[model samples]
Target: MEGNESLSSAMQERGLTQVELAEAVNTRLICAGHEGTVSDRTIRNWLTGKSQWPHPKQREALEAVFGCMAEELGFSPPARRQRPATEPESPVERRNFLTATTGTAASAVPFVGAPPQVGTSDVLRLRSGLDALMELDDTRGGHEGLERAALSGAAEALDKQKLGATQRIRLRLFSIAADYTATAAWSALDARQADRAQALLGRALYLARMAQDPVAEMRVWNSYAMLAHQRGALTEAIDSGLAAQATGITKRDPMFASLAHARTAIGHSNLGDRQAALRSLGHAREALGKVDRDQPRPSWMAFYGPAELTAMTAIVRDRIGDAAEAEAASHKALGAIPKQFRRNRALATTRLALAQLHQRDIDQACSTASNGFELMTGAPIPGRMRSLLGDFYRDLITLAPDAGAAREWGDRYRAEWSRA
Candidate 1:
């Protein structure tokens, strides 16, 4: 049998390795009250066409994970299992039966004209698009297309929310809308358009409150903290980070709590509160230690693991003028960060370069900084990363105005900077 190119391409686009894909499918299985038994070997079998069709439960979980039909992922039913064309489902029967069952299988088809009866399946379908968007953001950081697509998703969710749904379904739709809006805000922030992000985040927060979704609320607060930090509003950043920590999701998920604490630590350090910052950093580490790695989480949070926390620690240490400690933390982050996260790797490289520069390792700093450009060779540098690089460039010239190495560094990256 030929390899499952469709499945391979899907995984590649999402930057998911076979092991990660297995883990994600298993997480969804566990969430649906099934044993999370999918393994990397099983994923390999699927990719190699050793398994043409997954078990029914696994299929459902895969559909949920990818937000598409099993067939779309290159799975094929055996001849004996294929439904006969002679017994085809009529349009009305298909519609009414699907509306009654509220199954996610119907999600492969888009709703046309009037919105059909909304249900759990509809929410899952919408979330699939969000999952794709999140993957794109991870690969490319931020761009205008991402922001526009997020807003369109939000609009679609809102449109469906008004078309007769159960109270629970209605709230879930609102939550989805909030999630989409928050994604838009995040994209804007990554693009360094702080004002646009602020407005979108405000709207997202309001929608999240309406839905009473603590997770969505926490996501918005996290973005708000980053936006505040970008604007030099350290107090506001701290407050927003604290708000994220206060969200109910943090109480249930230690990983999320750790992220909130880490964000708060950055604000505290930047505000010159070294004691408070270090305290928060300690809290972050403690909470991270208690996280349940096997537990299922939303796709948006795939980036916030130990690697990201270590990166945050580097930022905090840098802000507190602990150059050596910052450099060590940055090194740790780069060592642990996954290869698929090119933007993150580049960002960490820039941070490492900054630490080296602060330590007066002029030649070494220039070399380290150049690695960021290499990491993101084919991709456009994100605005936030470009800003960080700009910071490094200015500091380099200021510290070594007459150094040949500094002049060489500028000559090399000048074209790259202008292109970005």
Candidate 2:
């Protein structure tokens, strides 16, 4: 790489021509919440070093563009206070990104020095503890127990090498988000609470950003957007889902795009955009086809796979009331999923139950949800998974009105929930 040069000239010398630089930088400034107008000629002046800086805001934007220290760029560095970041648009966002939630995925992902022997031990502790929590979950009530279990993981001691560096950081982010989403899944199992799941999963998405991991971030974001379906916050969920698509996962990871499309389908379904939902489903299928079977995937994404394409397609089918297709797809996925990942197997099985019970036989729906009940009961409640079922509960009640049975289940859940 050339020695760092004037921020202006560097932009010109790089692929970006001067006019392009001005436009791109100016647009970024606006996105950064700058209000002032900036022109290409003015940008040209800065490149020629004819004008030190046209504006403080413009200067700051240039600095971010170059990825070089301003001092190294042959210009006096902008004052520390100049062009300060504007307040985040939302308190929730403020905490996750600009403000505070948690950071270190960035530090964790990049392995430096001599890399240590990779072992399952680090993730093992988390995995085993998760196993215990799942084991403790009662089909009747597991979310509450799962919530405590998730909190316990936040305290798990992790070293830099657990996952370190930029690429690994994406994996790290996916893992944390997966854990939280699992916890939320359990919570949603009983309470049908999307908001709670959204908070935790959304935080996971933020963690991915800390590591600058976009692929992981997309999955995390999709996990949370499912909450939108539960809360009837259709627009918000779709918008949130779109963020993943916009982030644009490249490289070999088609699952990122697959997951995004699945969530988009859900959002479109909620908004009653039936065609859009189908379109998104097609996209999800295409994305799934692109995912290399043996490529590394995040633990959080373990719940999803080529098998999920069936479930995802079923979801769209179910939404459109194509009970026959939905039932077949769900059953296919359920059959394909291995039992080694029992936690996920349970959920997929339950989904199969959903398709059968809903489409073929009223008795079948009962049996399937009941079967799901059996698997989910003792299953570890990954918060995100429970969130996935929140709507299932609603749909179950609407279709079956098993008030007494559901109450019995709910009571059992509360008891175990209280125990946890």
lDDT tens digits by residue: candidate 2, 29-92: 4434454256677765665667654465665555444533344466653576443356332212
- RMSD per model, one decimal: 10.5, 20.1
Query: What stretches of model 1 exceed 4 Å from their correct place?
Result: 1-115
Q: How many residue pairs clash in each candidate?
A: 0, 29
Q: After superposition, how far is residue 35 of candidate 2 from its true place, in Å?
A: 60
Q: Write the per-residue lDDT of candidate 1 for residues 159-229, one digit (tens) a residue.
A: 78777799999999999999989998998899899999999999999999999999999999999999999
RMSD of model 1 against the true structure: 10.5
Question: Can you give the lDDT of residue 325 in candidate 1?
Answer: 99
**Runs off by more than 4 Å, candidate 2:** 1-195, 248-252, 341-360, 376-420
Error of 1 at 106 (Å): 12
In model 1, the clashing pairs are: none
